[model samples]
Each structure stands twice: as structure tokens, then as C-alpha cells.
Target chain A: MPKQMSRHSTVLKSPRRQAGKPRPHSGEPTHGPLTAEELQLAVRNHSMPLEALRKDTTPPGLHYVLTHFDIPFIDTDHWHLQIGGAVQRSLELSFRALLRAPSITIPVTLECAGNGRSLLRPRPLSQPWVLEAVGTAVWTGVPLAYLLTQAGVEDDAVEVLFSGVDTGVQGGVRQQFARSLPIEEALRPDVVLAYRMNGAELPPQHGYPLRLVVPGWYGMASVKWLSSIKVLTRPYDGFQQAVAYRYQEDADDAGTPVTWMKVRSLMVPPGVPDFFSRSRILPPGPVLLTGRAWSGQGAVQRVDVGIDGKWAPAHLEHPPAPFAWCAWSMPWVADPGEHEVSCRATDASGAVQPLEPVWNYQGMGNNVVQRIKVTVGQ
Target chain B: MPKQMSRHSTVLKSPRRQAGKPRPHSGEPTHGPLTAEELQLAVRNHSMPLEALRKDTTPPGLHYVLTHFDIPFIDTDHWHLQIGGAVQRSLELSFRALLRAPSITIPVTLECAGNGRSLLRPRPLSQPWVLEAVGTAVWTGVPLAYLLTQAGVEDDAVEVLFSGVDTGVQGGVRQQFARSLPIEEALRPDVVLAYRMNGAELPPQHGYPLRLVVPGWYGMASVKWLSSIKVLTRPYDGFQQAVAYRYQEDADDAGTPVTWMKVRSLMVPPGVPDFFSRSRILPPGPVLLTGRAWSGQGAVQRVDVGIDGKWAPAHLEHPPAPFAWCAWSMPWVADPGEHEVSCRATDASGAVQPLEPVWNYQGMGNNVVQRIKVTVGQ
Candidate 1:
């Protein structure tokens, strides 16, 4: 019999462990490293563990979890791309043709459409993403602008449409999902129709053959399993346009509709109330307080790190590459005491993270200040 | 040691026997049906088996193959959604709240970005799809527009963003994926942020808790594992925008650089040439000419079926559900001579399938008329 299989990487270790009693903080005047049980307890409660305290950047393996149905595999040899609509001529190309075009790679950040949903007062009806819905990638492919130019997009062209190859049956309903974009963004020089990620060909798990990579926008803009591109005079109201990426204003306990939300950011590490107690021991002195920052509008201009409500100058790492998270660090002089750490960021477009809480029905674009507590002791 | 597991369904029959070769026309033409040996050969070569002559709608199990990657599973309790960006407030929600929202259901078709790719000459680098990348389903979810209205979109808001909780590495690049829509489309009534597919909650294979159900477009925009949404003043310029979705003009080979492709449709099934030559004993009597039709623009207004290059009208199912392939059927009136059949479609937007070929870098937007053949008896 042909084999049936489930494939997951062997390199990574599962973070989930057997359940135990939740750890309660003891207000004792002592300094020592936390026990393994204490670390597991903290994580179970959605709090950062001690190892998470060691680095500002959350390791990819330990990042939060979010998944839908099973991942699908797509063969690339026979893949094709079709471009039609408000253009002088329509075209269809092969995967090899797409790769031969002028290639550009951009480092971009993709945040989940519902990041930080776990933090909501009344949990939303979705995966409980414990703040791990973000990542950086170098996408390489031909620019959409280059293609549209070749097609001779008409002056009246308004929107660009995108589609992918994945299919599934939800209940009994069959779906041919798709989304569209404005011609303006479709013609942007940096907008890429990527076939490669990092330095390698796209993995089947990702969109192989071709996928749309629109920077500075949510990941939805980057369609996977891409097949067709249509230039439209007006707009097409597909389910995604009319339904998916939206939010509600009123804090209705029932949940709001999906629409766009406000700009927001998150502190990478030293999570809110990071420290468990004054008795917890910390690493050696002169520690590096590193974290990640990003903005929906443009590049992050600056990030501020504060300890115990006092602002400290932060060492901002110019984005390692464009369209990526900006790494920032602060050198802290450790002393045995209770410490509350926080970070905030400002974007080049003059947008800054909010210090107070903001509420939306869908829990979108939430860039509230990130806070973590730490106890420095020998 | 951890026990190894297999995901194969016990309820289903063995796939091995199902994967067989099509039969050759012979005898009274109706007996044991196509042997297993013949069926396998037909599928491998992207050819139709003769057994298709007996039925109207393709059996569910025999549906064409198209996929982006492996199926994924995500823990629901820990999943959450985050919404923020260009709004009055940022919010975070858990999976629970999303399910509690007022939900609506609608039928839509979701096709792979690469359906009919095998029709492209000179082979592309991806899967060789034979026009089965599409499916229809009744999706239930809250209108994203409703959510956006609740978000109290700011005056400058131009684009709405969507993010997913799903994650994977492509070409060594780690990305947290998301997509977006224009404000106009975002407010459309037809769009839905779906959580339940058909009558039941979405299966894990199909975005479990929620996914964007953008009708009339392609599949990628319906980002699964939704986590966040954002509103922006200007359009996004992420890698997916500039490089992946775009296609090249006049480049037919797989090596060409193309960003986006044109809008096109194919006549699946009845009109597909060489419809089914794999069976040895073909079904006798009136042959049912049946197929599916769809377009990237909107609803398919009409589908025409042709036998032996002679045009004949086919009846399209009523209420032609949006984003879903419309099923059509017609009597073949089998004669004693060899005959060829074909089918074509026109969408509500006045876009019709082309008889001639169009060229593009990625070979997307095929929409060429599909042809099938049948040899009648002595």
C-alpha cells in the first residue's frame, strides 16, 4: 500500500508540555535562578519564560502559534501565470519565464491579520495567537510594475486582481478564493511577483511558482498560488474585499465586522510584566535589551526603551534590510531590584505607537506599548 | 519514543486501486467500467479517461489535483486575532469572540492560481493542472465591511489589511503572511470573513476559525489563520505586490519574468478535448456533456458547449453562485462517427473565453476553449 504520512520538521522541539499547577508569585526577598517548573508555568499562562528574557528577538521556533487547515503541496513544473484585463495585450508565462525576469529581493515583515488577539478582554473566535504572528523574509521575483508596463495598463485601469491555487472544502462549500489591488500599488516599483524566498526557490508550503508580495501592506496583499492578474476599470467585490480584512469600532461584546484598523506595533521581548518576582535571578551585568519594531506606513524612525517608567536611550539597528523588522537594543546596568521594562516606536511617516489601550472588534492594527517585568539579581 | 502516526482516513477506500489506468473502447462498451490500469495512465499524462462519457458532474473523488503545500493544523484555544492601523483604536481578540459574531453564509468559488496550467506549452516550473483548480462552497462568516464600519475608518484610510496566523519557511525566508483590499471593495456587501464552510465550522484544512472569502478573485487573498487587519492612507508595496502577482508580456516560456497575468476561464469537463479515451468499454446510450465554468471578474453569465466544432447551447445551473464554478449539462446525441466537443464561457462583465492563445511570462490566464473527443460505434 502507498504510504500515508504527516510531515513536520524534526529539528524543532515541541514547546507544549504536560500540564501542571500554575505558578504563583511569592513576595520573598531572595535572589536565585528560576526552576524549570517555574519557567514552564510562566509560559502556560501566556507569560514569557526566563529563556525568553535572554533575548529581545523571539526565536522563530518559540514564536506564537497560528495555523489553519493542513498545508498543501503544489508542483511547480507545469505552473503558469495569466495576465489579462485593461491592457493592450494579455499574456501567460511559465515558471521559468518568471524566474528569468529582472529579479528584486526585498526584506519584508508580515504581521497576522489578527495578531495579539489573545490579549483581548473577551477572547475573539479564532486561534489564540499569543503574540507570535510576525516574521521577516527576502522575497525575490519580477516586479508587478514591470509586467503592467509591458501589458500597457490603460490610464483608466483602477484595480489589479490576484488569485492562488490552494483549494479546500469548508463544511460542504467549495471556494475559489481571490483578492484585488489598485493599479497604483500594482504598478509600484517595489511590488514583486515573487517566485523565490530568501535565496532559494519558494517551498511548496509557501506559494511556489508565483505569489504576490506587496510590501508595506498586510500579508493578504501577497496572494499565494497565484494564477491570474486582471486590470479592472472599477473594483470587484470578492468575499475578501467585502468581508475578510476589516474591524469594528464599537466595543460590542459580540465581535465587530472586518475592516481596516489603526497602525500599531509590539515590543519583541522583555514581554509585559516580564519578571515573575524580586527573588528571580537574572543574567550577568551590562545586558543588551534588544527587540524588534515595525510600522505599517514606512520605516521605523526610532524606538524608546524604558525601565521602571524612566526613558532610556535605545540603540536602534537600522533595519537589517528593507521591508524587515528594525532591531533595537539598549544597554542596561543591572542591579538587584524589581524592574518594569517597556518599548515604543515611531515610524518615518510620523506615526508612533500608543501608550494607552485601543479596542476594535476584530482586534486589528493593535500597536500598543509592550511591557515586560524583570528582576536583576546575582 | 513518540509514536509515529499517519493521517490517512479509515472511512475512505484505498487510493491505490483508485489510481488506475483508463480503459480502451471495446465490445458493447458497457460492462465492468474502466479498469484500474487505464485510469492511472490517463491522469499521469494530463489526459481524460473514456469513463467520463457516462457521467455529467465529475465525481468528488476524481476531482483534479491542485495544492500549494501540505495541510496545516493549528491549536484553536491559543489562537487570537489582532486589529490595528489607521483607526480610532487598536484591539486584540481571541478565537472565541470571532465565532460568536453575527454570521452570514454565501456560495462562492475558489480556484487555484494555476488551474489549466498544463495547457500552457513549453511547461512551467510548477504543477500541471488540468483546469480543476476551482471549487464552490457556501461560506458563513461576518461581513468584513461590517467590521470596517465598526472600526470607524478615518478619512485618509485607503486600504484594508489582513494577516494570518499560519507560518512556514519559503526559500529559507520566514514570513508572517497578510493581504489587503481597497476601501471601496472593503465596504462591499458581498465580501465575507468566513469561519464556517458549507454548513459546519471550517475544517482545519480550510482556515479553521476564519479566512477571507473574497469572491470573483483568486484564492491567495483569502489569507488563512487570520490574526490582524490594518488601514493605510496609501497602497501597500510589499514583495507580493511588486514581484509575485505581476506577469510579463509576450513571454510564453517558463523562464520569462512576469509579475501578473490576465483574466481567463476554461471549460472544465464536457468541453475538454479528448474528454475520456482511457476506458476500454465506454458507456452506451445518450452521452451527457457536462462541465463547469468560471471567471476571475465575477459571475459566469453563460457557458456554450460545442460538439464536433458545432455550437450548441448548454443549460447553466440557476443562481450561478459567485466565486464558484457554475455547472452545465447538455445531451451529446452520440452518433456513429468520431466527434469532438468544446465549451466556452462569458462572464456577466462581458468577458468571454478566447479561442486563440494569449501569451504571458507565466502562462497564466489560459482561458482557451476546451475540446474533447468521442468515437462512436459500428
Candidate 2:
């Protein structure tokens, strides 16, 4: 018997998940043609263009962006970040109050958990990103630890949840765009409540008024348009925390939650592109290749340029900040022929980007190396 | 015989076009599955979120964007807007010099020529927009007419061409992003050399340093990242002017050039949306239906809200500025059942959006009325 379904019961695809899949969607196929839902999501969200790798601090507008729901228009005069739930004394800080708090500005690189989803063989039918979903920005705000301590967090609290005004349904559950971090991790000095990006007030799309900037973790952990904080006594089972952004080998697997960004590198395509095919057409001469490299777990220690599968070390610049991406470059003399160029990065912790994509059901943490093809025209 | 193809000759999809289709792409299908190329373009170029209609002037970060190529990194110190060719006095104005010129700030609504392409049958194989590609921003800069007068246009000049630094190949032609306006239209008091949007310096994505704002014209005519201006004695036949942005009946037609935006109205989807299907769920009773309406041909004079295809005039606020979109709202008693709601706009020039989508080969100037479905759950 076919069961009647109300639209509300239909699972809304998260920014990282496909919609309308079968129940329990275990046999989620690895790859398929892009869907109408995916196209809808793609146009509403955008990523850094590869060419932006040339800049150190990405120009604010060129940074990758993925908003789970509509950007909320906050009236700064009335807006406040309320901290409650299992705290000794709840703290409500107005936008002006937040501005007066001790501020620290630092550069950070943020990459979406599904940065290379489209490159996965059985591509997870989500945003369909082909690399490019990464950017670095200088942020100014108060450290999360500074506020949590001032609010007097209760000892029993196991995690702290952040909630934003943006709301939508995903996985058949209507919910605010929210997430939680473990208490110990939430107290990290680097986690900030940012109000400024680059040198200006936060752009609304990047979460104006107040936003959480969780360094080292994938962008999902850096919640935007934040409105509240809840110190919880128990682990958070929110939709964002327990259901999406997980790496699963099969449908039924509970899946490990994704966190830190993996070591990765991308090159600015080194020639004039054939616009339609995105193939490079270069004149035979010495070509200087350039790119950016980063990782969440540790500093990027090395980058290697792959010319038609042959490896050569590239020069790496000092990282701008603790978690910011570093620029890298190499010189190659062009010959009259077609050639393939690839770049790979290794982090201080020694996690190197894989030569080929490592596929997963939800398509998270895909830090596969990037390769570009160019033809040297005489 | 099967014709051989070189990747170069392959037509790369333009922001408003499809690639690799049958040359003389005349029988371009009206409906088909979304392709990888279209999806790629969608993520790179974003549109306004319908909910943003609530704001009079779109927040800077939420404005719709369509870039045909990578954003150029301009060095303001060295960048200059050179007015040359048929001008009586070829003049070069540095960024600072342009800023020092007389200035004005006004709100202007800009809509993409292909705003509703995705809704067309045999959908145009381009950026598949669904009625969200429009935004209004307050632009501040020198009036373009002021600059032209300073350069002293030669009497023989027929068209004034503007070139941007961003370059890419389109229609198999590698060229900078360029477009031209008739000399008369170029002298309009409202046409401006905008350096600031909504207040601050233009964001890189919106065209930093300098951009052109042609009120009452489709977005393509308002060039960004301006590098130079060439006044031509002969009619301009650049690729952007001659090959793209045209209204055509079939593939082989050298259709009339597309200019003014057609009258259009878009409703904010009333009630909360079902995450997956985007259907609305509302409690039964009186609810406010709100949206924005505008036209490049003339001021939006009226907007009609349709409840189950029944029409009622909505109340419109005086427009924020001559060319900015006006907000409109209507009240409806949503009953407990499935219903379709739609809105249509009529411009002062007597142009009304058609109930049906007006199709075209290039998918330009599609001003179809927008419709949404909802279920009032009792």
C-alpha cells in the first residue's frame, strides 16, 4: 500500500545532503545526474573562485559562503546574544555591549566539509562543489572562552549549543540553523564571537551583528547569524550535531561526525582559459604557477607541484596566522604540448591530501588534490 | 560523417547561454534535465533570496550577482578610467580623480535579463534562475554624463562602449567583459560611474574601485570593474552587443537586441516552507502576503495578488527611489486546503506580466508572473 505523505514529512535536503531519497536512504548511490534541488541550492550559495587564491586574506566578497537558510535582518539596537541554559547566571549582551568587549582580530581559513563533493565518484547529491569551497578572512571579535567564563558555566554542562535566527527544515525536522561544541573544545581561546570581517562590519550574508567563528573546525562549526547560546548538561542531539555532516560508508552507519579540515592545495589555472571547456591555452614561455594551501589540524608544512605526474617541491610562504592558508608557488617553462598540473599539500601533522578522492555517503572532509590541464600554444 | 571537435571550438556556456549544443542551436529543447555545466554556473553566480524582498534596499551582501569571468584584482592607485576613441578630448581619470568629480547617490533596482529562465519550457541551458535575480542598492559615484561632458563626445560618435578588466571567452571569442550604450542613453542624468554600493566601497564581487549603474536597464548594460570607455563613430558590434542578450524566436534568428527589463512581480513565499519541496505550511486565517515589483520600462504602477487564481490589488508604498523596487502587500484568509498563490505587476507604460511564461531561444527578458503553492494545515 502506498502511504499518503504530507509535504512536511518530506525530508528537506541539508546544504550537504540530497533530498527525496528513499526511506532510510541506505543504498544512496555514489553518483548521479545533478538534481533540481541541488541546482536550487547551488545558485543560492557560492564559493571562492580559484583565481582568488592569489590573495592572502581573501577579499570578503570572494570568500566561500553556505547559508542553510535566509540571512536574517537584525536590528542592531535590539539584537543581543543571550547565554543561558545550565549556566549559573545567564548573560544577555547587547550588540553595543558586545562591541565594547575585549576584541581580538586574527586571520583564519575556513573550508566547507563537503568542499570537493562533486569530485567524489559516487558524488553525494548535495551542493556539487568541485574544489573551490574554501577561503581565508581576517575576523575581529571576543574570544568564546572570555564570555563563557564570565557567564559562569555550570560544571555539569557537557556541551554548548549555538543558535542562529536562520531557520529551515532538514531531515523532516524544522529547526534553526544550530550546532554544539564539546565544553572543552568550546573553551578554546581561538573560538571567537566575530562581528567584523576583513576591516568592516560583518557582511549580512556572512552573519551580520554577531557570528561564531570556530577555527580549526569545518565551516559548519562556525555558525552564522547567531542569536543565542545554551550550555547543555547532556550531549546535543540537534539535527546539525547528530544527523548531517557525517562520514558514512553505508546508509545505516551512524557515521563519525566530521570536524577538522584536511590538508589540501589548489592552483590558479596557469593560462588563458578556453571559457567553454575551462581548458588552458598558454603561450610557450616560462610560466610561474601559484596557489594556496591549508589544513585545520596543523600548519601546512609542504606543497609539491605535479607536472604530468612528475613531482617537484614548491616554495611555501609563512602562514599569515595560526589557522590561515599559506601561499605557494613554482616556476615551469612551457613547451609546445598539452600537460597536466597538480598540487598537493602536507600538514605539519603529516596528513597529505589524497591523489584521488576518498568517497563517503554524505561527502564530507574531501580534501583531494587539485589538477589542471593546459595546452602550450606555439 | 561525424565532424571532429577541438575543445577550443566548443562553445563554452555563457552566463546566459548553453555550450556544446547543436550549432545554429535552433532546436534547443525547451525542457530537459539540468546539466553539469548549468549547475557549475549556478553556484558561481548567486541571486537574491526571495525573503530579502522585505528590505527596501537589499543589504549589500544579499544583492544578486552574475559574473561572466573571474573578478579582477584592481590596484586603485594605478587603475584609471580612460575615455578615448571618438571623444573630442581623450581623458584618463585616476580612481581618486573620479571620486573627486561631482557625485550623487540613488537607489536603483537591477534585474537580470534571464531572471526567470529556469521556469521557461525547454529551459535555457544557462544559469537556471527562478525569479530571484533582482536587487536594489543605493549607488554613489560621479554621474556618467558628467564624465562624458568632461571628455567632450565627438558629434560623429554613435555608441559609447565600456570595458571591464575581467576577461573570458564567450561565443568562441576571447574578450574582456564589455558592453556599449547609445550615445544618447549614455548621457542620462541617472547613469552613473558608481564607486560605492549601499554605502561602502563596492565589494569586489559587485565591482570595486568603479562600476557603472544604468538605472532602468537590465544588469548587463551596467558594466563593472570599469577599465576604459571608447566612443565609437560606427555602431558597436562587440560580441556582448551583437551575439548575446537578444530576443530570438529560433536559433538562427539574429533576434532583436534585449534592452529594458519587462514588468515582473515576485511574491515572498507566504508561510513557512516545507524544507524538501518548498511548499508552504500555514495556520488557517488572515495572513499578509508581501513581495516586490518593478520594471525597467517604467515605474511599477500596480501589483495584483492572486489567491487560487483570484486577483486582488495590493497596497504599494511609494518607491524608495525612481528606479528601485516598491514593496507591496495583500491580506488573504488562507483556508484549510491546498492552494496556489501568484502575483503580477503592471508598469506605468501599460506593460503587464503575462500569466504564462514568454519563451525565447536565448531565454532573455522572461518576466513571467511568479506562483507558489501552500497548504493551510488546520
Candidate 3:
């Protein structure tokens, strides 16, 4: 997620509030500038509900959606992906051509780097996000590496830039949503220019016609509504690349750019009451604890549950797909009283989640441990 | 934490089980090899209770304790720290003399590298630790850097090894418990040869006479029962250094050694019921979500709460100290229903807690997101 820009006062006025203007995209209620009330409603309605997250596969309608502005209006009949800049051949490939290309399908979890930004103290004052900025889906598309090869990337190319059709004023500058990755990362076999999500043609909210799927990276790197691919000899200094998605230590430091999704795990809510509520009560008995754990760096090796404060081993179910999260559970004998429960996961790369997050200006990768409280009664 | 070795058959018989044998450490019932019954009692009595974690400062008695072997009996009156190996001057400084040296006090959280080991799959078959292997204390000690400088470290010195008096057979090898750190890390300002913990002389279970506190690194790197410091021109290949504290990717790769504490967070149970129990039932009302967030890399910038997958910004409290965790809370309006709640934290360095932990052979640094379940009723 890019750092939100200064709000343009003129654009804050919703099109609906201006007059009897029809919504920008027919059939898509969430496609135009939203009134304050509509914005809140949109956030509530568009978020991937916890109920939907309990299943192994995320249904398309339940997919988490995050966009900087309105979803771009794209006509599939006229859409084309332009490949230029440090490439020997500049080519414009229509949607049909992309569909005809050899395609591969892989499951990947795309998380917004700014997923927890709204929770930060002295908050960023923009994009008040909660954790619903993440989702996993099976994406089917041609490898971007293959497309780059077809365009014949020049020898001096150092970075690959992806630009989307969505444009707005951010950080006091008008620009398209653009980001760049090192050539090495951009050329990974799993990097794709996707047109299908979860076996269906891309939904309008998910960048219909085309989008970049830079697996393992934060969603910002996977530019939605991707329109152009540019091979660059120098690192791209576009707004998103140089300023917005960067993790700055302070005003003085040249920040590190957000990249791969950190290792994380989330449990499917066991049938229970609001965990943070004071009125939570329960009857002591045996209970099963379960959740899903995954990592962008490698496979999950183990997951342990900390019941109260005692740690116990958990049983891990094999992942459905290579990059999918592993399901884990542990049975606990509950005693009547208040209890705090939490779990930790270790990954193949030896990286474990931290008890706390490393703070950055952008609030990019907050993967801190999660805890919940519950009450029990006879 | 080093891997456990084959147990000596002769030592398996607990003195208590042998009948009428006096306890090894008078007044401390937890000393020596424990009988099955004693093991259960010790686990019940000695583990840090979760309620104690709710405060800003952890009381010494409430601090968590973990050890690989019996606590060594060290006479503070006769104890001395031996500094030798690749140093120009070899010196043995008595406890009093060491205390006379310049001392600084700093708060540091020490977490056992194997703190969550038992939680891993294929259970480690060793110390089955559940999460109570971590605590924070204010340590006062002369800087190890000062002593190393006085000892005149050799130009070629590459590593500094710390040896502890507590020793038993581990990994089938009989040797003193020892670990080494790179010269650069050893020379850090926070590395200390400590004689005090929380303003008092170190406790018996906490390496009483002397210990090394390597803040920021896992507790394993901070050798307890400190006896000697050895500077080495070559990398130290002690059992703990070469074979145990390392995180192996697979049987084929030379695993990376565990180092700094990863980012993580945990909430103090907010007066609730046993979360995992099936019989949990509650009356809906407002609930307060609260917890402490900290990081070894930097300060925590944010902590967000996820209520049934819907996210909300949390209000954060000022940290009591720079190294201490920042307190945070979110007011939640509970609706009658089953719900799961969780939280994530971001640090000043931009590192976020992972939803899951990266897996490793050593099961070190498992920092995964945590969740709990509860039921609300009318």
C-alpha cells in the first residue's frame, strides 16, 4: 500500500451527491467516489467477513478488496498491455492474446502492506485500514517473465516497472499508480500478469482485464488494472516506488521498500462470543484450538499454542497447495476462569513471528503476535 | 537453547524417588532431577502465571525461569570471572571487584530460544517447553566491552565465547554449557557481564554470582551461571554454537544460527473466560482489548485488533521505558454471537509480526499471530 496522499478537496465531493449522475460503473455500487457514509458502508460491505475466511478456499465475492481510488473503467474489447522501455521490441498485446498465451495457476496470498496502518499511533491520517486488506486466491495467468522475454528485455535493464490505469492526486502530485521491482525479483518464475482469479475472469474490483501478481510481495507490487510493463535501466522513482510503499525509519533515513509478505497465522474463529468483551463467559471443558499458518519465505515447520501461559505442541495438517497455509490444532482441557490464548509459528527459513512488530513510518509489515481473552463458568 | 542429549540412565532416578534422600538445594523444592509427580507440581508452581504479565514491570518472583540442567551451586564469596583466550592479558576478577567496575542498568527482555519448542510438529522429543520461558528485568553490570578492552583483545580475534558453570551431558557430549558471539556483536554497548537483576543480586535460578546479558538476542545467547569468557581467533565451534543453537533448513544445509529476538506481541488476558472451551457463553456488552507490544529491533508503532475478521484501530498508551512494551487497547461493542479476536503489531523498524512463524529445525523464534474464541448471549 502506498502512503496516502493529501486529499484533494474537489474530489471528496461524491458524484452521487453532486447531482442525479449515474454511478460510474454500472452494476458496481462501489465504483465511484463515496460519500463519508458510503465510504464506511463500502468498507463494511466489501471486507472479507470472518465467516468467509473459515473455509479453505476464499470465494470471489468474499475476497478482500483494496483500491487507492475508484476501480478503473476498462473495456475488455479495447484493453491491451503495452510493453516498452528498455526492451528490444515494444509490443501491444490485446486481452485475447494474453488469454491465448500459455498459462499457469498458483495460489497466493496477497496482503496490503498497510493492512494495520489505521492502528498506528499518530496514525498516517490516510487510508484508515483494518486487517481486511489481505486475501488468498488461486490466480491463473501467463508468467510475466515469459512476457518480458518475449519483449526481449535489454541487457542493461535493472528494474521492471508496472503501471496501472488508476490515476489520482496523491502526495500533492497527480500520477498513475505505478511501482517497480528489481529485475531479479520481477523475473521470478511465479511472477504473473494475471487475468483470472479463483477460476473466474477477474472481477472489476480486482482489476478486470489484467493485473500483476508478484507472488510473495505485498499487494502494492502487484499493480491492479495493470496497463503497461516498462523495463528500466535505472530504479523507477515513481511515487509508489520511491515514497509511498517505502518503510522509512524517520524523516532522515532513505527507507527500505516494502516487499515480501512476512510469515503470519490466523485461527478460524472457534464458535464463541466476542473475545474482547467483558461479558464473555464459558463452562469449563475440553476445547480444540485451530488456525492456519503460512510464510512467504518458506514452509511452516511448526505451530504451538500458549494456553494461559503454558506452551503446548499442536497437530499440523498438510497444506492443500505448496504456498497455502498449513492448518494446525491442539486440544486443551479448560478450567473455569479467565484465560489468555495465543500461538506462535516457526517457518522453514527459521524466521518466527515476533512478540512485537518493528515500527516503521509506513506501518508496512506489522506481524506481531495476536492474543484474545475469554471467560469460563461452571 | 541447545538440543538435549541422551540422558544418563544412572541420573534418571530422582533422589525423591529413591526415598529419604535429602533435597539437593534446601528451601528450593524444584532443584535436581524431578519425579513424575514433582515434575507436574513444579510445572504448576514455577511457571509464570499469565495474570502477572499484565503489569508494566515484571516482579522478580513472578519472572519466568527455564534451565537445561540443575542450577549450579556457586559461592559468590569465592566466585570469579575468568577472561582469557585471545586476549593479551588474562585476568580473574572476583565478584566484589567486578561490582566495583563501572556499571550501567538497562531493561531487557530475555526469551528462551526454545521457549516455544514443544509447540512444533514432530515434537522435539526434548524439553517440552510451553510459552512461560520468557521475562524482562533491569540488569546492572559492567560492560563486557569495557572488560574486553582492558584485557586487550587480539587483532585477529573473531569471536568471544561465554562459558557457564551449569553443565550436563547434552547431545551425547559432556561439556560445560557455552556459546559464542561474533566480536562485533559482543562489543555492543548493551552486552554486559552482570551481577544484578532487577536491582538485587541475581537470583539462584538466574545465574546468581555472574551472567552475561546479550540484549536483543535470544535468551540462549545470554549465558547464565557465567564462569569464563574466552576470545577466539577462529569461530567458536562449541556444542551450543556449532550444533545446537543453529536453525537448519534441512538435513543437507548448514543451518543458520539463531540470533536477535524476532518481532512479537501478546495481550494480557482482559478478564475473560477460557477461550478454547466449547461451553463458553457470554452476555453481550462493551469489551476492552488490551496488550503490550515491543520489539528488539525498534519501538512498536502500532497494534490493531481484529474482531471477527473486522479490524479497528486501537488506542495506544505511552511506553514506560524505551525498551519496554507500549500498552494498547480498543473499545469493542459486543453483539450476541460467536466471535474470534486477535491483534497485530508493527515496530519502528518496519518489521511487522507475521501471521505465522518461519519454521526451523531448532524451533527458535516462533512469533505467530494469536487468536481466541468466545460466545456472547442475551
Which number leads on DockQ? 2
Q: Please give, as one word, the docking class of candidate 2.
A: acceptable
Give per-residue CA lDDT, model 1, range B186-225, as digits (tens): 7778788888765656654466677887776556666776
lDDT values, one for every candidate:
0.53, 0.80, 0.65
Reported per model, the fraction of native interface contacts reproduced equals 0.00, 0.46, 0.00
For all predicted structures, in order, the TM-scores are 0.42, 0.91, 0.45
CAPRI-style class, candidate 1: incorrect
Q: Considering only the true interface residues, what is the Cα RMSD of candidate 1 after superposition?
A: 25.8
* Clash pairs, model 2 backbone: A30-A122, A31-A122, A276-B12, B30-B121, B30-B122, B30-B123, B31-B122
Which parts of model 2 are misplaced by more than 4 Å? A1-30, B1-31, B274-276
**Model 1, A1-378: lDDT tens per residue?**
001100111112223322331111121112232222222112111212222223333322222222222223456677679899999989898887887889887876666656654355543333333443565677789999998898889889999989776443221223344678777778878889988766656644356668888776666677777889989999866645533444543222222223222234445333221111111235447867777777656577788888888886587778756566777778887777767778888776666666754445445555567666565655
Candidates 1 and 3, the one with greater lDDT: 3
iRMSD for each candidate structure, in the order shown:
25.8, 3.0, 24.9
The per-prediction tally of clashing pairs is: 223, 7, 56
Q: How well is candidate 1 docked (DockQ)?
A: 0.01
Residue A130 miss distance in model 1 (angstroms): 2.7
TM-score of 1: 0.42
Q: Report lDDT (Cα) of residue B23, candidate 1.
A: 13
Highest TM-score, which number?
Answer: 2
